[model samples]
Target chain A: MVTIPFIWIMGDLLWNGWDQLSFSFVFSAPQNAGREGGIGPILISTLLIVGVCMGTAVPMGLGTALFLSEYTRHDHVLGRLIRGSLDVLAGVPSIVFGLFGNALFCQILGLGFSILSGGLTLACMVLPILIRTVEESFHAISQEQRLSAAALGLSKTTTIRRILLPAALPGLLVGIILGLGRAVAETAALIFTSGYVARMPESLMDSGRSLAVHIYDLAMNVAGGNPHAYATALVLVGLVFIINVSSSWIASRWTSCNRLSA
Target chain B: MPFSTFFFFTLRVFLVGPLLWAWAWEYPSARAEGERLIITGSSTMAPLVSEIGKRFETLHPKVRVDVQTGGSSRGIADTVNGLADIGMASRALKSQEQHLNGSVIAHDGITIILHTSNPVQELTDDQIRSIYTGSSTNWSHVGGPDSGITVVNKAEGRSTLELFLDYFHLSNRDIHAHVVIGDNEQGIKTVAGNPNAIGYVSIGTAQYDAAHGIGIRLLALQHIPATLETVREGRFPLSRPLTLVTKSPPAGLVKTFIDFAQSPQVHDLILQQYFVPLQG
Candidate 1:
């Protein structure tokens, strides 16, 4: 409780100043020292990286889940192996993922410090959680739905698409939200792979920094640290809260609609 | 078409297209051979090191210099951990950093900057200390216009902030819980743009600004200007050395790079990069 208010006070110290938290600081290009400017490009770059990671992870996660639960029998060797592998993948630390991404995506693929490299690296990090949640949602469906779909002579793919996927949409959305939260908050992996430039991402090839990295840079590298650190922290917390609440609300609404249709 | 086909198509459009696009464009080959120098540390020194790296690589086409910025502490840590060939810092090393061989590459003076619109010309060391430590919250208490003294400081783990505190003899003084910003540039921006603001940054960086959009007025300490001459003469209170540390002294390609860095060829380059070159 004490730390929470202290955190808020820290945030206000950063944003309260005209010079530190000006509109230009957020919107325009940064100038040299003893000059006024903005960080609009970095903000946009952060969002672009986050968007790519979430977009890729959601579908891949759902597909893995579907393969594990609906399509494969419990006794199948491949399904068991994949399930076990996912459990291990989720347990691996983020720094390890960063190392892997640096080697595999950045070095082998020629994607030097690009947003695409960072996002793709993040997708690999988020994939395990996505797969697990989506699989659980598929498992939670009632046996009766499967029986009824089979009775109707619905094709395997059709039953999965129209019935299982729609039924599991809410849980799948939650998985996506969770993945997004992790991706947005992540700093270590993106720091090495994404690379920090002050400009907005021009292409998948452009180097960029996420908001968390920007906050870290501001608090640690930019001089006179505390006020800017706190202010950037405030912005970071606000962003995370917005993403969390909005995703939860959207997921709940979709789930309610699915229930009504069922 | 079946809903499955539609869903697959949706997945393909959203996930596969972008993922493949990112993968193909970003990842380059990971082959490591010949001349490769990995450097990590202070962001303040990153641009400087990068410039030197660029020059060195031009001379030796086979060499590749990869520079990454973490904080100064991380730079020292990277050098200790054998993760980097060089660790760059804007401040002196701690006792822990003593295990590595440290060489002074350059020197910089930390200038106390304020907006030019403010009427105050110079601030006494005590007044500066009182304001930063929060003993004086308002600018008027220190003979300036009546406004809250918005003290901007570096975060924990920064060598620049640590050096400043030491310079002010405020190492033990509890910093007013509010003042924080990270780099010298941002501090200059915050102070130069705000009438009531006071902050610190490297004089070298201040000189790099040609437009002077922020109009930073440097404060003199105890009748001495925070100039490179005063800093070299040991008269300036806020001057500090820039050190490059390594776990082991340079050998092979790394030695060639270090020798090049210390050469007169890179001396002019250092001045162009806004840092004063070290004299033998």
Candidate 2:
């Protein structure tokens, strides 16, 4: 049943977008509101947005995970409070995050509609998921390992830096990858923050449209933009597929290397 | 040990990469060298204006025109707050928005649509009102197939819904909608897929889709055939002006861009987009 939807979507995208996919289509500037030309600027904007999202999210999510798993007891009041909020945040619909981002970042912070604001908004949205994933990975590490480190008289920070982090690397990568998928595929949150400018952004302060937003605008708003919309969707699906495969490959390779070294 | 090193290396790259890219790619005071005009609002008018903006950019290398779309109200709000230099609104400025200056660049008509296979060729305003109000539930009552009618409606806050409500003299509360759609294409697709479905959308979009062999037909409203020609000739009853709004009378680069948009140079672009240029 899960594969059915995947096959159906892939089939539809391929059937409609195969002919429209070409070198120039991926590397040229869009014309006539994305009816013609390539998605070069949109691709760059998507990358930049993801970069900002990951850069901000990784440190914060890792710190929160460490705090939850190492610095505090599971039943500690502060830890419980943090977990409750994160659970609630994870349940909050993305549109509410979009509206909140618009009010706080675009209006209050005076960032207006820019990639930086969009990235920050995305970082906020993905933090709960990232933190939860990393925390679970930390917990999956056996208590015997921690007791052994303590017996060896290693400091807490050193144990975390040299032992815990390397062991939890795969889960961290998975968390990053999952958060990345959500950030890249996002349309609603970005439409309010990053904006819909199709220009090649020269700076983070400049407004640039993401691929999802471009696909949305082309399909829903612009007349006669169906073919290009299909092509863009195909490219987006391809991108997610690549990210998933590459991350899994990295995880497997890292685990094998760890086994060989041990 | 190698794994730890590699992990730290990846961490450093993630932490420092964006900052280094931002520093290296930062333009040396590019804003001072070039003028940028930010225009926001009205998803319907965004594409046409974006095309005009691109042409304007080619003409003047030092100028940048950035167009953004949310909705007509956002356009007005942005213009009022000075967040955008210009706002694109697809409807006439209401009395509350009289302080803002508006310039009409083109015209778009709203027309009733149905599946092409349906035998109903036309409908009176009273009949449409009855169908929407649920007083007439079956297509047989409207001189069509003997099946239940599917009433498709635009979501709230869409200018199409507002215009529809105004023309029909009905409130959104009064209509019984089976399906609510966001954009013209979705509405068209719904009606096209259902032989008993009836909906309304931009005449330009409906005509384009119909010409492309989408199984949808534009129905004549009040005996006037819904065609681009009628919209161009100013005889279409339910047409609205695609206007650009500014907080005050436009001047300088803003005025120049607005003038360029209204000039005959962009008529081809306008016609290409299936919208009726203000000029004949």
Candidate 3:
């Protein structure tokens, strides 16, 4: 029942964008506000930002999750404080994150309107979910698994490194996938940080517009930009779908490989 | 049990019925005591109309003036459709739109703006054209620092965009824009933020922002300064008249209000909003 509207929207975008989504539309530089030619540069910017966001978020999330689960007691003040802060962070609005990102990364830090600043903002946004997911997965591992690793004369650090990490791989991948989704779909946070420049990112300092921002700019500002906006949305959906499938495949292969080794 | 439930539902409805009725039935035109006037169109003209409407209400005491904003097209449409008593337009009426009468109420001009820190104080018309066309890539080639120039352009359908394109003799499709902004403030902000960026916006707005210490400077247009004095003297080239449109010859309160808006009564108000008066 919930997915009825989702299906309807997807169908509508595909129907609208299908005619415009040709090879030239995807490969050539936009001639005028995505009204002509292609979204080649915009597509590149979108992928560059996703790469940057995932690169920053995943390791930080995994590390924080490990710290919360293994290093501290649940009732410890520091642990409780970390958990409380993560909860609050998750609830913080994306627009507020945009402002904060502008003030800190763009202004104070002097990163300016670049992919680096946008990626950092997205990293902060996805942190809470990452921390909670990885922590839950690590905690769900049996007590006997740890006891056996110890009985086999493995050090606590070694057991956590080899056994715990591989065992929690599936959950970590889930966290990565969710973070990627949020990062790919994000527009507000990137508006202030990355800016709305439809150009290839020459360096980390160069401003670039992501796919989500491109749709927003095309759909809202330009008078006759709906077709291009729909096409970009369709392409964005396809890209996210591909990422989702590939990550799940990688997770499955890991699990299967681990099972064979054991 | 069903009867009790039904009784409770009817009781709840009875309790809320009057509140909903009162909300739906508004006391129309109570303040002005008589006729209602609807003014629609041109977002740029909305503020001025709203200001004049307030003053007109006080003077008439028996007429209600309502101001609405969409765009110039809506203003013309509303006038033609009899949806509004008057339409406000920031651009000149087309030949097809000449079915309606338009009276100039105020004047504003578009001018090039830049970050205050840029070393280049003025740019030649050709230099600006080249910059907009992507022929001039670096700020240093035109006398600023060596950096890639970011062109901030206005979105389509805005009268400002129309005026800019017409004045430059360029098509909107040809100019490569780094950022396409909707409003004047956004253009000013984009220019203020980027030392290498240049954009055009309402000169009055740019002047106001500059007075308030917003790090933006208006450049001279074709060797003539963009100032209130120049615009009033008819020396500025980019000037556009802001008009109040009427489908038919305005009658009653609409006639009275349009006359008042074009008279000396709202001169101070118009100037306060950083627009040139109809006479000036």
- Rank candidates by lDDT, best first: 2, 3, 1
DockQ of all candidate complexes: 0.14, 0.58, 0.01
Instruction: For residues A61-109, write the lDDT of model 3, one tens digit per residue.
Output: 8788988888888899999999999999999989888889978997789
Q: Residue B259's C-alpha lDDT in candidate 2? A: 95
Cα lDDT, all candidates: 0.73, 0.89, 0.78
Considering just chain B, what TM-score does every model have? 0.85, 0.94, 0.88
Off by over 4 Å in 1: A1-56, A63-121, A124-147, A153-158, A161-163, A166-189, A192-262, B1-35, B207-211, B228-235, B267-273
Give TM-score values for chain A, per-prediction. Answer: 0.87, 0.98, 0.97
Give the alpha carbon lDDT tens digit for every residue of A1-262 in model 1: 8899877765565555434665666667533211235557666666668768878777678778888897799779999999898899998988788878877887788776668788889999999999998888898999899899999999888888788887787677678778888888888888878865544344676677677776666554543333444544555666777877866765565656555655
Candidate 3 segments whose C-alpha is farther than 4 A from its true place: B1-280
Query: Per-residue CA lDDT of candidate 2, range A117-206, in tens?
Result: 898999999999999999999999999999999999999999998778877888899898989899999999999899888888888988
* Model 2 interface RMSD, one decimal: 2.2
TM-score of each: 0.64, 0.97, 0.52
Which docking category, incorrect, acceptable, medium or high, applies to candidate 3?
incorrect
Most lDDT-accurate candidate: 2
